[model samples]
Target chain A: MLATTIHGPRDIRVEEVPDPTIKRPTDAIVRVVAGCVCGSDLWPYRGENPIQAGATIGHECIGVVEEVGGDVQQFRPGDFVIVPFCHCDNTCAHCEAGVQSACDNLSMTTSGQGELARVGQADGSLVAVDGGAPDAALVPSLLALTDVMPTGWHAAVSAGVAKGGSVVVVGDGAVGLCGVLAASVMGAETIIAMSRHEDRQRLATDFGATHVVAERDRAGAKAVKEITGGVGADAVLECVGTDQSMGTAFAVARPGATVGFVGVPHGVELPVGKMFQKNVALRGGIAPVRRYLPELLELVLDGRIDPGRVFDLTLPLADAPEAYRAMDERRAIKVLLQP
Target chain B: MLATTIHGPRDIRVEEVPDPTIKRPTDAIVRVVAGCVCGSDLWPYRGENPIQAGATIGHECIGVVEEVGGDVQQFRPGDFVIVPFCHCDNTCAHCEAGVQSACDNLSMTTSGQGELARVGQADGSLVAVDGGAPDAALVPSLLALTDVMPTGWHAAVSAGVAKGGSVVVVGDGAVGLCGVLAASVMGAETIIAMSRHEDRQRLATDFGATHVVAERDRAGAKAVKEITGGVGADAVLECVGTDQSMGTAFAVARPGATVGFVGVPHGVELPVGKMFQKNVALRGGIAPVRRYLPELLELVLDGRIDPGRVFDLTLPLADAPEAYRAMDERRAIKVLLQP
Candidate 1:
């Protein structure tokens, strides 16, 4: 099998690697069918985070079960499944509360290189698709359910976007575009996607954003306020984790509104006094993607949401390094890799 | 008229001061019947906060309307009323949402001394004592409603102490003791009061606390977890605004629960990462006392709650500086002054 590895900053390579095998009773060995480049992957890719000599880089994936361990009862060989970025045993109290990202057994990659990927305490980590391997068209949708789509959904829902709320989505990344779609599906009456990129903004608009403004902070907030009858948006989805985006999200929301953030926070500090005075809530983290997979799959299956639209480029697994570069350079909104 | 002033940290004086008169359209002059010392006041009383020399002190009071401005319509000149520590117009969006502390025209303290108070936004700041001029038995309760008592109620309620939910009240002061009562009134299945003082703990038990513990942090959180079948309390009212107290509240709450905090945040800082992981909400700031006045007044009038029990010490208005000293020295659980 082939896997992508990061050698150093901006240095990505695809090479032959040992195929993964089931190790735990609850585990299922899945042969990767498709994986996509994630915005978070760029953290180490851009050297913002330390990178090991070689590390298995992808988390968002749709795969076929190659084998199942003895205790695995929900899935079988040849079944299609989606695997989330954060692995957890589904029965823990935190997982039960749908906060898998904070699951007691949750694991993350540090300055370590990968070996055979082990889905720890797998029962809650993998969501299986019905029956046989899924159709080719469903690949991006399945991969998305594992992270980006559900993450976008979490951002929208956690911001407490109601049926008729005016929502402002910050970030023009794939996840932000997906958030616009998620807000629309959740019945948001007005969706504003803040974007500077033409292609990404188009995706946001197509995803149901009623408006787009290539602005942030005071300017973006002012535009949103004007559009919202002087009351800011009811909810703001912060897909970018920087302090600037968080501030923009906070400033663009009305009193009693909330800001849902799915991006991994880095150097972001909350202004407690303002949040308290405005009565704004901060919700969302590494979204419990697994929790929303089933419902999201239904939406995708019913043709109600086409999350795959976020993918602007797709390459064979052999070109994973190029895919990373394309995304890192902002040349591709999302890169779908066939494995 | 006589007034209490903070000459410096740990220094106070009781002396003659000019009498207050209505100064705004919404103002009401009250001949204070009773007033009490507050824990927050000690921030300045202890010299922790920068208090100007000889600044008038007290904020809580219950009194008879001595005069009213042209627009004061809630009470007649002879009516008795409760003055919430922070006056609000009650008609602002925040006030309409029952968040009086965040009202657009937040009141600044006008009367600084021995009870006679000039309350701004009179209609919203004053709650009429319609059952008649309150009796001596109701005096303390009315004063309690002016600040600490209602603040405690707001803490318990914001913590989402649903009927039959298990609760933990942190803090040994009057507000914490009152929180135990508030939780009991809200029908919590078990009320655990965390206090070190035997007298305060006894008062907590008398006020319906099911259990009392002196432990805090992990020990206290562990004890509370054990008491709640190892799942932690359903609601934790943090009445101490210190970093440790906030940590204890977060550690002792079950997933998806709320930590209601009424203690004026001091050196306290929220553990944002932990809060996000726990999915526990931090709600309730300075209590909107006026918002709860109506309901609390009914409870007091109906003989369902005796918040007066928190007033363990009573002194002549002329000795308010001594009351402040006793409280600052931790010699008095709460001190009341009769004007």
Candidate 2:
């Protein structure tokens, strides 16, 4: 089996690795049909996040179950399913509360960049696509149901983006673009997407952004406020975890609004006094992808949302390094890999 | 008019000051029937929060409306009303959203320690008691409605404490004691009060704390966890603004729980990483006292709750200095001042 592995910074390679097999009573072996490179992978590729010498890469996938353990009653061989980025028992208190990402028995189950992967807690982590797999043209959209789409949905819901409400989305990555789509789906009347790049801005506009602010920092916040009649938006979605992005999210929210953030925080320190004075509620964390898979998959299947358009580049598994470079260089909004 | 003023740290004095009058079209003058010393006032009295010399003290009061400006339509002379600690223009977007404390035109209408105090934005700041003024015995409870009661209610409501849910109330001050009462009113099944002092613990228990954990910091959190079967409480109301108290509040909440805080943040810095990993949502700020006054007032008038019992000591207006000293020395849970 061919898999993606990282040797060091900017050192991604496709190498032959042992095929996965069910090793636990709650495990299932998956033959990945489609995988993708994430913006987060750039963290270690850029050396901002350290990586082991030969760590297997990729965490998002859609595939067919090749084999299932005895305890995995919900899934069996030959079934097409979406593998959530995180594995959980789904019966713990946190999982029952819809925060499966914080499940008591939680593990990052990333091996999607490979030809085959082992999924633990299979009964709880696998969401089978209704019927069988869809046409090849719908694979990217189905794959998105694994992570980015749900993450974007989480940001919107956390920020309390209500029907006919206004939302300002900070960041133009695939997740941010999806957030704009999610906010629109949630019935937000005004969707503002912040982007500095032409291509990303176009995608944002197409994905239901009513307005776009290309400015950065305080100026960007000023732009958002100006567009919203100086009162700011009803909700601000922080999709970029940088300090600047966080600052803008708070600044562009009305005094009583909330900032929903799903970005992986890096070097961000919230000013307690400032947040308190504005009465802004910030709520978001890693998305419970499994919890949202059913509805999102239905939406994708019904063609209500085309989040799959985020994949601007697709390549064979052997070109894994090039896929990473395309996304790392901003040449692709997101890259889909065929295994 | 005799009023309480701070000349410097530890220098509370009841001195003759100019009487307040309607200064704006939205203002009203109220003759205070009862006023109380707040834990926050001691912040400057103890020299922790700096104070300017000759600053009027005390912000909580219930009084008879003596005069109203032409624009003050909701309140009029002779009406017995609760003066919300924070004055706001109810027409602002924030006020419309029920976060009156964050209103665009906001002011802290203090001078409650004096015989007469000016209420700004009178229409938005006053909630009249039904059926006119009640017996003099209810003065203390009416006074509680001004700040502490609403503040505690804010903590409970912000934390999303629901019926059949468990809550952990941090801090044992007047606000914290009131929080216990608020949680009970909200139908929280298990209310755990964290207090180190016997007097406060007694007040907590009386306020409907089903369990009292007389431990601080880590031990207190441990006790709460042990009591909740190691799953932690469904909500945590942080009534103390200190870093330790904030930490404990998060420590005692289960994943996907919300931590509502009303204490003026003193030295609190949230660790974003820890909160994110646990999926804990922190939401709270200065209590929108005006928004809550009506419901809390009805509760008090109905004798369903007795928050005024928190004022264990009462003194004449001339003894204002002693009132401050008693609270500073922890000789009283709360103190009341009468003119």
Candidate 3:
């Protein structure tokens, strides 16, 4: 089997690897049909995070179950499924409480950008597509439900986006664009997207952003406030985990508003004093994509949303290095890889 | 008029000061019926906070309206009112959103310990007791609504305390004890009070704390976890603003739980990483007491709750210095001053 691996900064390669096998009775061998590069993947590619030499990478994918362990009851061979970025038993206290990201028995979905991947907790982690695999055109959208779309939905829910509420989405990455979509789906009356790049701003607009602010920092918050009639947004989605983005998210939130952050935090310090004084709340973290998979999959399959448009570039799995480079240099919003 | 003034650290004095008069059309002059020393008052008393020489200090009180300016509509002379620690116009965007603490035209109640105090935004800041002044025995409870009780209610509401949920309160001050009462009113099934002091623990048990954890830091969190069957509390109230208290607040919160904080923040930094990873949320600040005044006041009037029990000591107006000293020395949970 061919799998993606990283050796060091900017070093991505697709090489021959041993095929995955059912290691436990609750495990399944998934023949990945589609996998995508994630924004977090850049952390190691850019050396921002320590990398384990030649570690298998990628956590988002849609695939067909090639084989299943004896204990896996819900999924079987020939079933199409979405693999959540994180695996959970779905029965633990936290998982039962809808916080599957903090499940007691949690594991990351590594080796998804490969010909075959072993999925643990198969009965609880995998959400199979009803009636088998659908049209090829819907693959990317279905693949999105594995991580990004649900993450965006989590951000919107965490921010408490409600009908008739105004929302500000910080960051223009795929997740941020998805946040705009989530807010739209949640019936937010006003959606503000902060993006400096023209292409991302256009996508943001198409994804239901009523206003786009190309400014950064204070100017950007000022722009959002102006759009919200000088009172700031009713809810804020922080999709980029940087101090500047977090600052803007908090700054543009009206008193009693919440900032739902889905971005993996990096060098971010919360403004506790300002948050307290303004009665602003901070919520969110690793999204419980597994918890939201079933509902979101229905939305995607019903064509109510087209989150797959985020995949601006696609390539064969053998071109893993190029995929990493494209996302690393901002040439692609997100890259889909066919295995 | 006699008022409490602070000249420096440990310099609380009962001194003659000019009586308050209407300074704005929205102002009402309140004749103090009862003013209580707060936990926050000790900050300057202990020299932890910089003192402004000879400044009038108390901010919690129930009073009778002595006079009202032309624009004061809801409150009139002879009406008794609860003066919220923070005053707001009640019609501003933030106030309309139910976060009066962050009202656009916000002010503080600074002269409540005096014979007469001027309250700005009178129509918004003063919640007049219906049917005129009530029995004297209820004065202390009405005073509690001004700050402590509503603040505790805000913490519980912010933490999303729902029926049958479990709760943990991190501080043992009057506000924290009030938090125990708030959680009880909210129908939390298991209320854990973290307090080492026998007096406060007794009060906590009386206020609906089903369990008392006398440990500090890790041990306290451990005890809470044990009480909650190792799943941690569903909601946590961070009533003390110190970093250690905040740490314990976050430490004992279950994943997807919220920590509602109301204590004046002092050198507290949030554990953002832990919060993100565990999906724990942080909310609350200077409470929007005015928003919650009506409901909580009704509860007190109905004798369903007795938040005023937190006022364990009483002092005459001339004995203001002793009141401050008793509170500073932890000899009283809270002190009520009659002017």
Which has the greatest DockQ?
3
TM-score of 2: 0.98
* lDDT for each residue of candidate 3 in A51-99, tens digit (9 for 90 to 100): 9998899999889999999999998899999899899999999999999
lDDT score of residue B323 within candidate 3 = 90
Worst 10 contiguous positions by lDDT, candidate 1 chain A: A108-117
Determine which window of 10 residues in candidate 3 chain A has minimal summed lDDT: A108-117
Q: Can you list each candidate's DockQ?
A: 0.34, 0.76, 0.86
**lDDT (C-alpha) at residue A212 in model 3:** 92
DockQ (model 1, Cα): 0.34
In candidate 1 chain B, where is summed lDDT lowest over 10 consecutive residues? B107-116
Better of 1 and 3 by TM-score: 3
DockQ, candidate no. 2: 0.76
Q: How far is candidate 3 from the true structure (C-alpha RMSD, Å)?
A: 1.1
Off by over 4 Å in 3: none
Candidate 1 backbone collisions, by pair: none
The lDDT values for all models are: 0.81, 0.90, 0.92
Residue-wise C-alpha lDDT for candidate 1, range B1-339, written one tens digit per residue: 887878888887887778888778888888988887889889988777898887788888888888999998878788888889889999976687677887788885545347688899998888888865878888888788888889899889778787888998989798998899999999998999998888898999999999888887788888888888877777889898887887888898876667888876677767766666666666667778888999999999899999988888999988887898899888898899887
How far does residue B79 in candidate 2 sit from its true spot (Å)? Answer: 2.1
Per-residue CA lDDT of model 3 for B172-202, tens digit only, reads 9999999999999999999999999999999
Considering every candidate listed, which one attains the maximal TM-score? 3
